[model samples]
Target: MTEFQTQIQAATRIVQTVYGLSVEWQPIPGEVEVVQACIGGREELPIYLTQSGEQTLCICYLWHDDEIEPSRRTELLEAMLDLNIPMPLSAFARVEGYFVVFGALARQSRPEDLAQELAALSENALEALEAFADYLKQ
Candidate 1:
């Protein structure tokens, strides 16, 4: 198996055992090497893990463009920026049509570390939704 695949497997086990969370591996339609981990109870915020030569990324999609209130877009962006630094181990980002919260670690990080990242990203996703609720369409 590829290094990332190995990492994903190990991390999935750790996340389940350590955090008491279920993890489902999903394949992206066209991306052969990319898989997403859907955490139980937080299925709305699936975490996508990707690896490069130097680092691994853990990202959770938070909201889509159409989900945001048109007039509050700027304010939402500003709030995200303000919260970025205060948030632990995660930061806000825009990926194509979605807004996301993500964290990164060394490519060689331990499975425990990866599990921790998954937990943090999951928590951050929920917090982001709560924090930005006013800027979203009801």
Candidate 2:
């Protein structure tokens, strides 16, 4: 298995036992956001976790056919880490029904940068941006 494949194995085990979710990891072409995918297009509610491990990160993905709700995604991840709060992003939509790509908020660090990049906002996204701003404000 590739190193990332190993990470997926470890992350999946860790997330499942810890968060009560079973996630299967799949590697997508291009960018590396580490998102979860549902089996056979089941609505399993995807979960993406970004945590700093060793030097880099072990971002974990868990998919839900109900669709991975970003708020729930962030909540699940933060809960596992016991983090106070987490950066959030909007959900993903399947263009062709075969797959859907979750919208990534930012690389990691400086959440405000993500807010800034979005440039505008929907009410919910705006709320998250406002929360991020509040985090920066503190």
Candidate 3:
């Protein structure tokens, strides 16, 4: 197995053991593997190990919806930026129609550290959702 494969296994173990979460490893031929798991009860988080030279793994939480109001778009964007300012180890990103919070880990990160990163990312995403719950009400 390759170094990344070994690290992936370690990460899976960490998520399962420490977080009490199950991981579904989806390996694409000739590409990096993605580990999928549900965090914060309703959100599915995707953990990706970049195939580029950086050898970094990123855990991302995405809230995708086309229903975001145009009037609230600027408010949401500003809120995300405000939350990102003091956040440690993670940041908010907007991709397509999704609002994302992601944390990156080095290829050599320990299993414990991986677990911590995942937890941090999950908490941040949850907080963001709660912070904007009023604006996001259906």
Scored by lDDT, the top model is 1
Q: Write the per-residue lDDT of candidate 2 for residues 22-101, one digit (tens) a residue.
A: 45646555454443432222233333333234222222122233443544655544443442234344332333422222
**What RMSD does model 2 have?**
14.3
> Ten residues in a row with the worst lDDT in model 1?
26-35
Tens-place lDDT per residue, model 3, 1-138, is: 767667766866887788786665555555445555455364455544443555465656456656566678778778778878788778887667677777776667776777777666666766776787655637
Q: Per-residue alpha-carbon lDDT of model 1 for 21-132, expressed as tens digits?
A: 9999876655445778999988878898888668898888888999999999999999999999999999988999999999999989999999899988898899999999
lDDT of each: 0.89, 0.36, 0.66
List candidate 3 segments past 4 Å from native: 19-24, 28-32, 39-43, 49-51
Return whichever of 2 and 3 wins on TM-score: 3
Of 2 and 3, the candidate ahead on lDDT is 3
| Model 2 score (lDDT) | 0.36
Cα deviation of 130 in candidate 3 (Å)?
A: 2.0
In terms of TM-score, which candidate is strongest?
A: 1
TM-score for candidate 3: 0.73
RMSD, each candidate, Å?
Answer: 1.5, 14.3, 3.0
Cα displacement (Å) at residue 89, model 3: 1.9
